[model samples]
Target: MYTSQQPAIAVDGQNRIHIVWSSYLPIGNALYNIFYRMRNSNGLWGPIETLSVFPNSYHNYNPRVAIDSEGNVHVVWEAYLANEYYPHIAHRVKTNRGWSEVVVLQSSYRRENPSCAVDKFNNLQVVVTTNEIGPSYDIVRFVRTPEGNWEGPDTVVHFNTGSRYFPEIVATPDGNLHLFRRDFGHYTNYCYRIYYKRYKILNYVILE
Candidate 1:
């Protein structure tokens, strides 16, 4: 059997809903992979499709889904590949034609729990947690332009003695990006507290 976890959903302007999640299988070279499905405006659900490529003894989880202004579907997830010990954030986009190839964003540090959103101008924005520092993880953001150019893995939130993780991102129609995350061991002695930050977009630049 298989187990599913951390499902995310997004709706397009046409009212079609897309959903993605990670599925785990006990016996296979591919232990975990991302899967997706869609519900049409008529409320009929489409067949489930596998989103992660290669499988290849890698595990993927925490898939986040978003729909851009042009009706393209975007998914980002935490992937642990077969040949890599460190985790990476992987992204894929589906347009009217088909799904694009998987884009793996690997960094020197461990990254995971990606949250993604599409801005008013159709730029894809993503946020993930990085554990490069000693004590805890910090949240970082990445922006993918409509023309497929990528920018920024900038650290948006940091903690010296604790960890901030499991970030969630939202893009408003007014060109504002709102970020929410959970913190541990910082304010209340091992308790997780909710933290929020916002960014404004001007000419494709994210401003504090």
Candidate 2:
């Protein structure tokens, strides 16, 4: 019954709507995978496409989609690979030529809840919750340069005893970034808190 969960949507300059979500199929080689579907500018719906690779042994979840300035569709999700100790952040991009191969942005740590956004310069930025540094989960950022180079898995927020999750990021026309996420165990009186962070883009790079 987990056929659809955590859906993400984006629209390109041509007015085409792109959507991605995680699905669970008990009979498949992999129990969970990410699926994509789009609505054309003419309002016609296209066939649903499966976007995850290595589906034979991977369970994918928490997908996030973004559309760059040049119309490339970027998708990121969390996946549990076979025999792996923790989940990884996987990414894929669909351009004029079609979808590229699935790339793992982070595999060394326990990561989940990936979020992504494209700046005005066409650089892609992704964020996920990871516990690589410690037992407490931290919000980590990864930037894919406009020239197609990957930048980081830098930890942006940390706490000795708390965790962060469900990060969301947005890039504005002026090249500014806005990030928000849920915080847990940070305060004794409250169960959770919503945190906000702002960043600036310089030469297609995110500044601290």
Most TM-score-accurate candidate = 1
Query: Which residue pairs in candidate 1 collide?
Result: none
- Per-residue CA lDDT of model 2 for 1-208, tens digit only, reads 5668889999998999999998886435677889999999999999999888664447889999999888889999998877675899888899889998888764677889888999877888888888887877888888887777888877777788878888889989888989999988847345878889898878645686
Model 2 CA RMSD to the hidden true structure, in angstroms: 2.0
lDDT of 1 at 182: 91
lDDT of 2 at 61: 90
Candidate 1 per-residue lDDT, tens place, 137-157, comes to 888888899999888787788
- List runs of model 1 lying over 4 Å from the truth: 26-28, 55-57, 133-135
